[model samples]
Target: MRRAYSVETVRAAEAALMQRLPEGELMRRAAAGLAVACGDLLRRNGRVYGSRVLLLVGSGDNGGDALYAGARLARRGAGVRALLLAPDRAHPGGLAALLAAGGQVVDGPDGLGVLDLVVDGITGIGGRGGLREDATGLLHTVTRDRTPVLSVDLPSGVEADTGEVHGDAVRADATVTFGTYKPGLLIDPAAEHAGALRLVDIGLGPELPEPPDLEALQYADVAALLPAPGPESDKYRRGVVGVVAGSERYPGAAVLAVAGALHGGAGAVRYVGPGADAVIARYPEALVHAGPPSEAGRVQAWVVGPGLGDGRGAEAAVADVLAADVPVLVDADGLRLLDAETVRTRTAPTVLTPHAGEAAALLGTAREEVEAGRLAAVRELAARYRATVLLKGSTTLVAEARDTPVRVNPTGTSWLATAGSGDVLSGLTGSLLAAGLAPRDAASVGAYLHGLAARHGSDGAPVSAQDVAEGIRAAWRDVRAG
Candidate 1:
């Protein structure tokens, strides 16, 4: 698992580590890593010796890292220049070191003629809101030529804890983070601003605490969590998933949801809705029913609300599914009918999958607010409903009601923004729940597989929901192979 610590935690860890090391030793270690990363980028263009490097120095340690790194490049024969945003506030020691190494300080933007690369050290993790007007204007002028940018620690102007980008922010071609990943570098909105991420260990692991603020699962982690059949395993032993979806108006949703469930690790899929005939046509293996979910017979888990439109029957169906003692997943139209008290009172584990719009309605806020602050929105929903919440979008986040690390999915692609795609995810996660995985694990694993499947199905082209379901087997194979 890839762990991300909050700014407070990282600061504490850095402080603790700095105490044990000699004076300026910690900063030297960080500068060494930054210099190597800068050299690598310069090498790709030609060589570091003749590269024109520019540093955006601010009034913080981040600026110190940049200044020291500039000195390293200068000693290596690179023409390095520092554009100090705050001359008086700049790291005095670092500025002196850069000048001693033959690096010059440019008075203003006009002196920044041409550059091979730009190092963004305008703000650190502690800086919030966005870039100041002066920094923003200077950044705009520098980036007008489309010079590749390398942001130190993280892209300035993005919240390190919440991944929210307010006002003006630096968009970097790549970000060189230290010690560990930040929540802003992993989550979206802010994540999008960070093109590529590179982590440099400054040996803060021993100082940091267990159970980081956020985590992202890798291939090996997902492989171990995946379910496989044994020689003595039977259909019932594997698990059965019940899907209650689709209305007369949206029968295709039922078929798509069943498609995802069939591909999931479930032994059998039992579907109950008005779209029974359509599901039967697509998948004869699914057990179909036309009445309420109560009459749908035995199921280890239930997935409700894919295409059930607004109606009296739909409401009753959602209520009936919630009453079941099995693990339940609620999505789409079902999200609209959920009662916070009812969900909180459930004895069985409940998972809520909502997009930004749906999540906003549940939280009584605007969609834009949820989109801006996804980490907060997802955590709030999980706490309020007392259930596992999956906030789906550019980055799929799974948060448990308890104080555990939130899982951020890294495999998501833009191709997943299609009709019925979310319905497929709902059914897939529901199947995992039936397979006896905990709500949080099921949600995380489901998102991982869902994203990989979408990539396989799309493969640089447009893909339908059915194509994504078909790609599940391939995704499973790939994960196992690794």
Candidate 2:
């Protein structure tokens, strides 16, 4: 698992560690790492010696880090220049060290004639909103020149805790973060600006708290969570998933959902909806019912919604599934018919899967707001519905009502934006729930496989919903093999 700490937590850990170390030792360690990364980047472009390196220095420790790094580069025969945004507030010690090493300070943007690399130390994790007008203007020139930028910690102007970018922010080709990952580096919108991330350990791990604010699962983690059966296990001993989806108008939704369930490690799939005939045609293995979910016989878990339209039958089916004693997953049209009181009172776990638009409708807010602040929106939805909420998008997040670390899916691709992809995800996750995985684990694992499957299917081209569902088996094998 990849863990990310909030700014407040990171600050506290840094403070605790700094108190125990020598006065300037901590900063020196950070600068050493930064300078090494800069040299490596310069070497990749050409040679470190005689390379033109420009530092965008601000009024904080981030500026100090860049200045000290510039001093190191100067000593190595690189032509280092510092463009101090705040001359009076710059670190005095770092400034003296840079001058001693033959580093020069440029007075204006005109001094930024041509550069091999630009180091962004304009703002640190504590800075909020966006870049100031003066800094933004200077960065425009750098951007125009298409110079590769390396941010000190994170891309300036993005919230380290929430990953929200409100205004103009520096777009770095790469970032060398200190100690550990920040939420901004992992989440989207802000993550889009943070090109590539490298972590330099400064030995602050001992001071940080257990159960970080956010976590992303890697291959081994997903492999452990995947369901496996023994030789003695029978179909019943494994798990059965019940799916209620599709209307006469949208029978394809039911077919896609069943396809996902069949490949999601379930022993059998029992489907109840108006699309029974269509589902039967596609998958004869699936057990079909013509009535409500109550008459669908025994099932370990139920997946409701998908292509269910806004008719009386669809609403009634949703209600019937929600009242069941087994775990239930609601998606698509089912999300529209949800009642807060009914879901909150459920004894079994409930999982709500919604895109940004559906999530916005649930919260009675705008889609733009939910998209911009996905971390907050998903948490709020989980608390409001008292369930495990999966907010699907570029970064699929799974959050529970409890105070556990939110899971951010790292395998998502743009190709998953295809229609019926979400329906497939709903059925897959529901199957995991039937197999006895917790709501959080099921959602996270389902998303991980769903994304990997998309990648396997796409391979860089467009892929359909059926292609994604069919690719799940390959994704499963890949995870287990690892």
Candidate 3:
């Protein structure tokens, strides 16, 4: 697991580490790592001898890191210029060092010549809301050209703890983070701006909190979490997932849901809905039940509502599944039928998977609000519904109602916005729940696999729902291989 600390936690850890180190040692380590990365970029661009590098300097230690890095690059033959946004507030030691090494300060870059790369040091962990006026103007100047930018610490103006962009934030070509990752670097609104991330170890020890406040599971972590069939395992012993979805109007949903469940490592899929004929036509292996959810029979877990209508029938179906006292995944229209009180009253674990629109409806807020602050929205949904909520989008967030840490899924691709994708995810997650993974694990693992499958199915082209389902086995193998 890759842990992300809250800004307060990072500051606390940094303060503790600072006490043990020699004067300026931590800053030196950060500056040295940053200078090396800049050197690599220069080498790749074929201009290590005399490339033009511009640094946007601010008031905090973030600016200190950038100035020292500029000094190193200047000594190494790179023409470095530092744009001081807060001239009076600039790091005095850093400025003097850079000047001694042949670096000059510009008030702010206005009509300045294009540089090969721009480094953002406008804000760090202590910043809140948007960029300062001077910083925002400087960022606009760089955006006028194709000059690639590397953000120091994090992209300026983003909420370090929640990944929320308050106003204008710098969009970087890459971000160089010090010590451990901040929550903003891994979650979205901020994550969309922070292009690629490179961590520079500043030697902050494990005295930082355990189990992390937030995490993004890397391939190895996910690989370890996946269930492997034992020598004594049989089909029945693996697990069975029961699905209640579809109506006569949207029969294809039931078929697609069953298709996804079949590939989700579940031994069997029991379907209960009016679309049994359609499901049987597409996937004959499913055990179809045309009757009610109560009589559909035993299952380790249940998935309710993909294309379920907004009538009494949908509500009744969801109530029946909730009554089953098994792990349940509710998605799409099913999300609309949920009652907060009913969900809280349930004895079994419940998982809610809602896209921005669905989540907006559930929270009685505008969709834009939910998209702008995904972490807050997901947490609110989890608390209100008393369930594990998966807020799906570019960065999928899994938040549990209980005290467990939230896990942000970072493997998103634009191609995943295709129709019927949610149904597939619902099926896959429900199957994982049935296979005995906890609600949070089921949602996170399902999201990881869903994104990987999209990448495999798209191969840089358009892909349909069936293609995503068909690509699951390959995705499973690829994850396992990792």
Candidate 4:
């Protein structure tokens, strides 16, 4: 798992580490690491000698890292030039080091056409908004599509904590972050600006807190979380998912949801909706029920609201599921029926899956606000609803209530944006809930598997929701093999 800390937490850790060390000791360690990363990049481009490197230096410590790294590069025969955004306020020690090493402070992008690498140090973690006027001009004057740029700490202009990129931000080939990974480096749209990332340890880990602010699961982590069948496991012993989905108009949603549940490690799926005929026709293995979910026999968990329209029956289904003692996953149309009373009053664990539009509706805010500030929006929804929330977008984020870390899904692709895809995700998550994983774990694991399955189904081409559901088995095999 890749853990990310907030800017405040990072600052606290850095402060604690710095207090026990000599003056400028932390900066030197950071600079040395930065120099090594630059050296590797220079080596990849051919050699450090005769290579032209551009350093966009500002007034902060970030600029100090770049200027010092440039000095080290210059000593090895690379032609390094610094373009200071704030010439009067530049790091005095770093600038002196650069000049002593035979590097020059340039008026403009002198070798912009022939530069091999660009180092962005215009803004640090504490910097706010977008690039300053001078920095913006410098960035626009020299940067090209093929340039290999490395950002110091984080790409300048990205919000270090929230991952919100307002106005213009530097787009880098790689980001060399110190101490720990910031939330922005691991999330989009700021994460999109940060390409490859390199962590430079300055011994701040021991000073940091135990739990991270956010986390992204990798293969090993997901593999460990996956539910496995044991020797004594039987149909009833495994888990049963009760699905309340589909209306007369959207019968395909019922079929798609059941299809996802079939591969979610569940023994059986009990589906109760008006689309019983369509579901039974598509999946004969499903235990179909035409009555209300209150009378749908036994089930470990329930997944309500896929294509069910805004009607009295849909309301009853949602109410019944929420009233159950077992865990519940609410998605699609179910989100529309949710109120502060219904959501917060439930004693059982509740997981709400909403796309940006649905989330905006639930929050009584605009969709643009939710999209622009996804982390804040998701976190707020989880707290407000008093339930775990899976905000589906370019990046799928699962935010839980309390002090737990937010789960940022790294496996999702644009191909999973097809119609009914969310419905599939709902069933899979619901089944995982029935399988006894915590609400948070169930949502994260289900999202991981669902996204992986979509990638397999897509294979670089457009894929339908059915293709994604069919591809879940292959994804499962790959996970087990890994």
Candidate 5:
């Protein structure tokens, strides 16, 4: 798992690590990494030697890092200019070192010519809100010049912890963060501002806690979580997933949902809805039932409400599935009909999969608010429903009501925005739940595989929902092979 630490945790870890090292040891380590990244970036463009690199310097250690890194670049025969926002408050040691290395300080870069790169050391994790007047103006200058920027730790103006960008901030081409990954580097709006992230270890790991604030599962992690049938395991022993979906008006919903479940680890799929005929037509092996989910025979877990249009029978289907004595994953129309008290009082685990609009309705907030604050929205939904909530969008996030870690999925592409994709996810996750994974694991692993499938299905072209569902088997094979 790739972990992201909260700002407070990172600060505590850094403080502990700094106490054992020499006074300037940590900063030197950070500056050396920053300089290496800058050199590489310059080398990629052409040559680091004789290249012009501008440092947008601010006060505190952030500026010190930029100045120290500038000194390194200057020694390499690069023309390093320091645009000190606070000349008087600049780090004395770092400034003297830069001057000693033949680096120059300039009040304005307006007269400077084209630069290879702009280094943003205007703010560290300590700074909050947005960029100040001086930093903002300097940022505009670099933006107009079209110089690719490299932020020292994080972008200058983003909220380091919450990833809320309230105002103007530096948009970096890449960021070389030290020690650990901060919350802003993983969560968006701020995450979007931080381009390609590169973490440079400064030996703060020993001081930090093992558990992280947020995490994303890698291939090996997913592979371990995936269920593999044993030699003695039969279809029933492996698991059976019951899907209550599709209305007469949207029969394809049942087909799509069943598609995902079939491709998932589930040995059998028992589908209960009005689209029984349609589902059987597409997947003949499915055990179809037109009755309520209560009469659909035994199933290890249940997936409710995909394409369950606001029809009369859809209500009964949702009610029956919710009453089941197994894990339940609610999506689409089921989310619309969900009651706070009912879901909260359930003994079995419940997972709610809601897109921005559905999540908005659940929290009684606007869709825009949910999109802007995905982490908070997902957490709120999980707490309110007392269940695992998967908020799907550009960044698919899975959160639980418990104090467990939140999962951020980074494998998907924009092509997954097509219709029926979410329904496929709901069914796949339900299959995992039936296969004995916990609610959080089921949701997160399902999302990771689903997104990975979409990426493979798309492969740069537009992919339909069915194509993505079909690609899940290939994605599963890749994960298992990994």
Candidate 6:
């Protein structure tokens, strides 16, 4: 897993490294890494010797890093020009080095269109919300079309800790982050603007403090975390997922949900709903019950509310799941039907999976607001409900009520938004819960598999929910193959 710590942690680490190193060693390391990355970018585009490069330099150390890097490029025979955002405050040492290396500084953003690359060093870790008005105009003028942008330390205007954009932030083609990955580079909002991310080790590992506040699992970690059935494990031993979903109005949801449950490594799936007959017709292995949840046979965990409308039956089903002392996953209409306080009081772990619109309703905020500061919104939801909240979107974030580190699911694609897809995710996640995975792991693994399945099923085109479910076995194999 690639872990990201807060800005404070990174600063402390940098400070510690500085104390142990010779003067200017760390900055030289940063500048060297930047030069290498920029060179790689030029080589990838089939040129380096004569490529035009523009450096948007500021007053801080970040600008110094870029200026020194621009000097390196200039020495390599590439035409390099620096646009000084803060002329008076420019790094004295960096300016002297650039001038010595035959690099020239420009007074403004004019005539920057012909450059093949733009290195944004307008702000660094200490930067606050948005670009300064002066910088914003320059960014707008320069960032049209597909010109690749490489940001130093981080993209300007993005909050390093919260991943929130203050006003206007530079959208980079790639970000060259130093020392360690910042929380914003790994989380959404800020992450979305960071097109591609590359970490440049600046030899500050010993100074870095504790484990990160947030993490995104790589394939190897996910592979290691997956559950496998042993000889002693029977169908029942694997796990049982009790699903109270669908209704007279939506029988297909029950079938789809059961489809997901079966593929989710569940030994058995207990269906309790008005759509029992439909679920049985599609998935005969499912034990069907046409009654209330309490009367249904025992199950290891429960998944409620996929295709469930806002009716008495859905409300009662949610109540029964809440009453049970087992891990519960609530989704779809169930999210709209229950009160956050009531769900928070449940004895067992409760995982709520809601898309932006559903989450908006739960928090009584607009979808736009929820999306703008996704990390904050999800954490807020978790704290308010005292449950683990999974905010699903371009970047799915799972936050626990306690101080447990936040998990940002790196999986998911637009193709995964087909009808009934969320139902499959709920069922699959619930099955993981039934199999005894913790609430956070179940949600994260489920999301990873779902995203992989979507990619496998789509084959780069459109796909349906059935395709996604059918492809889960392959996705699981892919996850394990790593």
Best by TM-score: 1
List runs of model 4 lying over 4 Å from the truth: 43-46
Give candidate 3's whole-model lDDT.
0.87
For candidate 5, the 10 contiguous residues with the lowest summed lDDT are: 137-146
Q: lDDT score of model 1?
A: 0.92
Answer with 1 or 5, whichever has the higher TM-score. 1
Model 4, 208-287: lDDT tens per residue? Answer: 89799999888888889888879998776678999999998898989899989987778899999988898888889899
Q: Looking at candidate 5, what is the lDDT of residue 3?
A: 83
lDDT of each: 0.92, 0.92, 0.87, 0.89, 0.89, 0.87
lDDT per residue for candidate 1 within 392-426, as digits (tens), equals 99999999999999999999998899999998998
Model 4 TM-score on a 0 to 1 scale: 0.96
**TM-scores, all models, native as reference:** 0.98, 0.97, 0.97, 0.96, 0.97, 0.96
lDDT of 5 at 322: 85
Backbone clash count for every predicted candidate, in the order shown: 0, 0, 0, 0, 0, 0
Q: Which 10 successive residues of model 6 have the least lDDT summed? A: 204-213
Candidate 4: give the clashing pairs: none
Task: Name model 1 segments beyond 4 Å from true.
Answer: none
TM-score of candidate 5 to 2 decimals? 0.97
Candidate 3, residues 1-482, lDDT tens digits: the string is 77898888888888899899898888999999999888887788787668989999889799999999999999998888999888899999889989999998886676568788898888877789998776777788776777888889899899899999988899988888999899999888899899888889999856588868899987887787777678987766777899999987777788778888888888899999988888888888899887578798889999998999875588889888888878989998888887778888888999999999999999999999999889889999999999999999999999998877899996777888888888888898888888888888889998999889888988889988878887778889999988
Residues 1-482 of candidate 5: C-alpha lDDT, one tens digit per residue:
78888889988888888889999999999899999999999999999999998998888998999999999999999999998888899988889989999999998867888889999988878788788887787688766868899998899888787777877889999999998888777777788889888998889888989788888899999999999999999878878999999888888889999999999878999998888888888999999887778987999999998999998877777777888889999999999987778899999999999999999999999998887788889989999999999999888889999888788887866888998998899889989999999999999899999998998898888999998899899999999999
After superposition on all C-alphas, the RMSD of every candidate to the true structure, in Å, is 1.1, 1.4, 1.4, 1.7, 1.4, 1.6
Prediction 6 TM-score vs. true: 0.96
Q: Write the per-residue lDDT of candidate 2 for residues 1-482, one digit (tens) a residue.
A: 88999999999999999999999777888899999999999999899999999999998899999999999999999999999999999988888999999999989778567799999999978789999898999998866779889999899989999989999999999998998899998898898988878788899889999999999999999999998998987666678999999988889999999999989988899999888889999999999998779998899999999999986688889999999999999999999987878999999999999999999999999999999999999999999989999999999999999999999999999999999999899989989998989999999999999999999988888998988998999999999999
Candidate 2 worst ten-residue window by lDDT: 230-239
Which portions of model 5 show Cα errors greater than 4 Å?
A: none
